[model samples]
Target chain A: MKLYELIIIGAGPAGLTAGIYAARKKMDFIIITEDIGGMTKYSWDIENYLGYQFITGPELVEKFREHINEFNVEIREGQKVIEVLKDEENFKISTKTDTYFTKTIIIATGRRPKELNVKGEKEFRNKGITYCATCDAPLFRDKIVGVIGGGNSGLDAVLQLSRIAKKIYLIEIKDHLTGDFFVINKIKKIDKVEIFTNTKVVEIYGDKFVQGIKIIKNNEIIELKVDGLFVEIGSIPNSEIIDFVEKNQYNEIIVDCKNRTSHKGVFAAGDVTNVFAKQIIVACGEGAKAAISSFEYLKYL
Target chain B: MEKKVIVYSTKTCPYCKLAKEFLKNNNIEFIDYDVGEDREKLEEMIKKSGQMGVPTIDIDGEIIVGFDKERLKQVLGI
Candidate 1:
């Protein structure tokens, strides 16, 4: 088996940027990912990413893909990494179909959408419940939909659904919206959106499809009839493939200033790591740093 | 007879793009529908899949929701 100098385990903002840096350094590396854009593709309006004043999630990811494509980088898409094992000096990454050996590894797998875990959620999945508004909003055209969460993701879903759905019920457990001020202000102007703060979805009920949701607000139980439900509460880190690394309570890999994990020759970046900010630009910078750090570590080997 | 494949998707959906690219790369022929613009196709997609999600692929008569590459490979016998 040919051992690679490095293997980047994702193709999101972090993994893509790491690939660009690794290619510039002329490192023998390849990226293994289930998808190209990761969570960035689910975003609606991204005004914070540097260089572009405004860009959608998929648009920004397209630019990233283009940039990485400029280099002769190898990206194995549609391959999900099932396990990562360290054997003596090299790390072995096992996907569903094949296994790869690398001298160093960069984990930038990012995160996945957090589930509501309430009743009837699992039963109604894909029936009337969805996680990606960008992919499923058009199906709820002219119908009533409920959005759970007041964070950026939830607000983004509402913004997209406002143009499609007839009525939107924005439910949040907190007393106020927790997303960016700009998004909150934008959502406030939409009269069709009914904001319910300090509310909890107790149960979801329906027949084959979702018919309504039971929510508790101010010590009172309220039933809402909706055609679709979008869960955008938050996300959990995708850091379970490797169990040797230390993780916080949220399962986010712990990285130092240089994006180095507790285990040597293994680095992590982006939302998967314990980074203060989970911004796209932040992930990109961390990815570059992880690449450089891995390159430096490889010098002694 | 060749298997008929239909993909219901939107232009802005990344998963939809990925599914189309997968089909193209595998030398599979499929008809793409932009449900975001075509309301009739959108309704058709919902009625067929019993759900509202992009990249809903119809292979022959089986409806596979989302970009299940494994399922696609198995159903298509690729």
Candidate 2:
């Protein structure tokens, strides 16, 4: 097995950016990722990505892919890194199918959506439920659907579903919608969407398909009949595989200014890191810093 | 070759793509069902694996949820 200079763990914003920089530096590196875009694919509208005033998450990620494709880097897409073991001088990155020995490692494995975990959530999954609003919104055209959570994700789901679904029911456990005021202002114009605050989705009722959901609003259980349900509460970091890495209370990898993690020669970037701002631009900056840092660390050996 | 291998996956899901790539690299002939696209395939995958997560592999009658290479090798006799 050939030992590469660096092996990046994810293909999201940070991983892709790192790949570009590594290729420019003429580093013997390969990106082993389960997918190309990571969590960035779920963003409905990206306004703060710097270049483009407003581009969709998937759209921006596509551009990132196009830029990375210009380089001579090899991206082993769809490979989930199971563990990264440190051995003396090198690191062993193991995926579900393959393993690699590398002088340095970059972990950009982002996050996955948080599940509803309510009754029938499992039973009705993919049947009439989905996490991505932009991806599955078209499927619910002319159909009545429900959106759970009250944050930006939930509001984003409503925005997408509003364009297609006949009617939408937005449910939030909190007393008020905590999303941006601009988004709330946009939602106000939609007459078909009914907002239910301080509501908890206690149960999802379905058998072969999703029939409806049971919600508790002001201590009263009400069943809202809908064809689909989009749960967009939040996301959890994909840092479970690397148990050796030091993580914060939220399970985000602990990284310094240069993207160096708790372990030597091992770095993390993107939303998976303890970076305060989990933005696309921040991820890219951190990824570049990580690549440079990793290159500098490689000089010692 | 006697056992049938079927993979249920989504397009955007990285793990699903990797699972399929692993099988292809091993030269295993299998049918891939895109759960994210097809409603019927999604239902079929759920009924078989009882998992909401993508990259569910169905080897003959055995249902393996998520991408597990060690398990796949054992089942495939690789």
Q: Candidate 2: misplaced stretches above 4 Å?
A: A44-47, A53-59, A185-190, B1-78
Error of 1 at B11 (Å): 6.3
- Expressed as tens digits, the lDDT of each residue in A51-133 for candidate 2 is 79998776787698889989878999867888888877888888888889998999888888999889898777867888866
Clashing pairs for model 2 are A34-A78, A34-B14, A35-B14, A78-B18
Query: Which pairs clash in the backbone of model 1?
Result: none
Cα shift from native, residue A167, model 1 (Å): 2.1
* Candidate 1 chain A, run of 10 with poorest lDDT: A132-141
Please give, for residues A174-245, the per-residue lDDT of candidate 1 as tens digits: 999999999999999999999999999999999878999999998999999998999999999999999999
Each candidate structure's count of clashing pairs: 0, 4
Interface RMSD, per-candidate values to 1 decimal: 2.6, 5.4
Error of 2 at B4 (Å): 26
DockQ of 1: 0.41
Q: What C-alpha RMSD separates each model from the true structure?
A: 3.7, 7.0
State in Å the error of residue A210, model 2.
1.0
